[model samples]
Structures are given as structure tokens and as C-alpha cells.
Target: MLVEPERTAYDLRFRLLGFPIRIHPLFWLGAALLGAFTLNMGFQYLLIWMAVVLVSLLVHELGHAVMFRWFGTNAAIVLYVFGGLAIPQAFVAGRWRRILISLAGPLAGFLLCAGVYVSNRQFHWASNPEGFLTGGREVGFFYLALLWVNLYWGILNLLPVFPLDGGQVSRELCGLVWGPRGTRIALQISLAVAVALVAYSLLCVLTANGPALAVVPWWLPRGTIFTAILFGLLAYTSYQLLQQLRWTDSSWDDRVPWER
Candidate 1:
């Protein structure tokens, strides 16, 4: 799941908290496109939605960057279509360290979600609220919407699928349990999870109820049949990556650091 970026269109943006953040033009365009589809609103509201996308995704990636740096490594962030990536240049040793690095991103998201939830509640959304859905008209709606995104998306990213934070943690756990076979087992688990996800999404639709792609965000494929296609692709990619990395001990083997 971790690889060096192609360095295509790497435009250096502003810095914050000592991390030199660079953004790809595709990132903004993607966010704007997602905002346009996800939000049923006008130009001003679309702009606000884009702002939410930018800030929330930035916070999630920052969580990973901060934790990587805290572990004495160099890290940078790239915001992209689906989400952001925190590229770390240092090797994390030990299972605990690896798990910690993987967990940092989702932890950051949940933390942001909690903060936003508190703010939403403070704005009376939890009580006699005011916002897009309520009788009130203010930024409260934005707060609540972002709270939903962060909460749901954070938890979704934690699902035990390869390339996800939870998948990384699951690999560490499997490694501890199965030793050398852990990597394969982890990949197997990922494939299973991906299949289940697609099936669940389908079931939801067939039931004549809420979407089968419940976990799929509005920005993703417009919550259409492509949701199944997306999961299928993830399943295939996981299988392929497992085939590629199966030969190499990608820090998921049972070997000790020096033994590697």
C-alpha cells in the first residue's frame, strides 16, 4: 500500500506544523468533482463542501505524518481522489511500532470527528439544532455534515482491508499469530473482507431499503453499481500485491529486525 509517488505534478504548497506539504493539481480537481456530486447545493455551498473535504482529509493525513515524525522518521502528505497518503521515509521497527504508525491516521480522524461532534453539539445540532436540515441557516450544517464524514469515513478506513489502516494492524496481529504464514493469511483476510463488503452492498440494494453500499460515501461512484466494482478491484489489487510481496519479507514476516 505504501509506495513512492510518481512525482508527477508535485507542486509545493504551504507548510504547517513543520511538514512541507505538496499538493497535486488532481487533488483539488478531484475534491471539487466529489463536492459537486456529493452535495446537492449551489456554488457557495459547494465551495464550503470543498473546504470541508480539504480540511478533513488534511487532518487525517496529518495524523499519520505526525506519528511517523514522532517515531523519528521523515514524512510528507499527498491528498488525492479517494483520500490522502502520508509517505514516510523511515522504516518502523517492531510490531508495536508498525501498528502504531498504521493506527495514527485513523486515530487522527476519530479525534477530529470527536472535536467536530462537540462543536456540532455546541451549536445546538445535538439539541435544538440549526443548520441545513434544521430551521436554522448557518455553518452548523457544515459542521454536522463534516462530523458525519469524519466519523463514518474514519471508521470505514479502519475496516480490515488491505491498504487500510486496520488492514495494516490486522497484518501485524496475524504475523504475531501465524508467524511466516501471517502475511498470506492477512491477504486472505483482506480478500474475504472485500468480498463481504461487495456482497453487503448488493444485499442492501436488493432488500429495497437503504443502500447496500452503506459504507461507501456519496463521493464514491455516486453510490451506484460501481461500488461493487470498486470493491472487486480492491480485492483484485490485494491479491496482486500479495503475489508481488509474498516473496519478500515486507516487514510483515516473523523475522526479527536484525534477522531481516
Candidate 2:
């Protein structure tokens, strides 16, 4: 498999809350597109939903950043379309630390959902008509949607599939039993599982007969192409990891970088 390199418009270097951050231009472009598309809903309720989603994603990334820092690893978080990405410097060592970092993002999202649920239960936002009058029309629904999305996102990320945070956790855990070579093989299996998941999801979407098909905008094709590219990247990355493991096994010392 051939790996295609990522393209960028311009490199962005900045700092957030005293942490140095660098974002590729493509990431920013994706973020801008996401923001524009979301805000284009033109409804106050949707605007609130977009804000909550974006903020939740940021917090998810922040969870990774904080845990990475705690492990004495340099890391940066980038908010992009779909969700956020957390990149840790190569200096981050040890399997346990990697597992912690991988788990943090979803953990944060779960916590956010829990907090929202508690507030809703305590306040009875949905049951009271005065709640909307005081908080503006449909604000309660926005919060409900936000909480649901975050909770779902968090749980979905925990699936042991490739290119996802949970997949990394799976690799680390497998490393303990199978060592590096076995871990690499496990990742390839995970990729197969991911492909299956994508197929199943597409089937579900088609069977539901959602509005996605009827309202075929020009951007729909582009989105499909982008998704294909993402899957290709995941495939290539898994291949590369497998190759490295094979090389390690062939070597005299049999030392694998990914070994636990």
C-alpha cells in the first residue's frame, strides 16, 4: 500500500493556555468548513448545538493534552471537522503512558455527558414551559442533543478499531499478551473490523432512508471522497506498522519499538 502525504495550506504555530501548539493548515481549513456548515443551519437552536459540539470536542482533546503532560510528554491538540486530534511528540515513551493518553479523550467526553445529565435531571428543563421562556426557545433541546452526541461520540471512540483512540488502547493491551509482532497483527485485524463497521454504518444509513440522500448537495461527493481517503490512510498506516514489526523480527536483536 502506498501512503499519501498530507497537504497543508500554511503551518500555524500558536499557544493555548500556556501550551505550545502547532496546527497544519488542512486542519484549520476543515475547522473553517465545519464552522460554516454548522452555522449555516440559521437557527438559534442549531447554533447552540454547534457551539456545544465544538466545545465538547475541544475538551476531549484537552483531556489527551493534560494526560500527556502528566506523563511528561510534549503534546498538542487540534480541533478539526469530525472531532479533535491530539498529537504527542515522539519522546513520549512507555506503553502505560500511551494507553492513558489514548483513553483520556473519550473519558473527558463521557464526563461532560454525565454532568449534563445530572443538570437536566436536577433542573427539569424539559418538563417546565417556563424553562424555555427563561432560557430562550428550545435551549433545553439543544442541551439534550449536545449531551447525547457527546455521550455517543465518547462510547464510539472506545471501539477497538484502527485510526481511533480506542484502537491505540487495544494495541497497547494486546502488546502485553502478544508482544510487538502480535500487536501489529492485531492492528491489521482491527482495520478489517473498522472496514466492516463502515460498511454496516452505511447500510444502516441507507436503510433508514435519511435526508442525506434526497438532499444531495455538491459537497456530498466531496465528503464521500474525503472519507475514502481517510480509510486509505488508515490502511496504509496499519501496513507500515506491520512492516516495521516484520523488520524487527528479521533482525538479530528482535527489538520492536512498539513492544510493551
Task: Quote the RMSD, in angstroms, for model 1.
Answer: 5.3
Each model's TM-score? 0.80, 0.69
lDDT of candidate 1 vs native?
0.75
On residues 77-184, what C-alpha lDDT tens digit does candidate 2 reach at each position? Answer: 765446667777756788898898889999988898888777766776544534443344466556766687678668767877666787878888888778745587
Local distance difference test, each candidate: 0.75, 0.66
- Taking every candidate in turn, the Cα RMSD to the unseen true structure, in Å, is 5.3, 7.0
How many residue pairs clash in all the candidates, one count each?
2, 0
Residues 1-260 of candidate 1: C-alpha lDDT, one tens digit per residue: 65544556466477879887767777777778656654655576777777888888888889888988888998888776667788888787889988988888878878988887776566655435433444244365576657866776687778888888888899899999999778889889999998887876666556644654466566542323445766777888788878877666564677767966
The alpha-carbon lDDT assigned to residue 53 of candidate 2 equals: 68
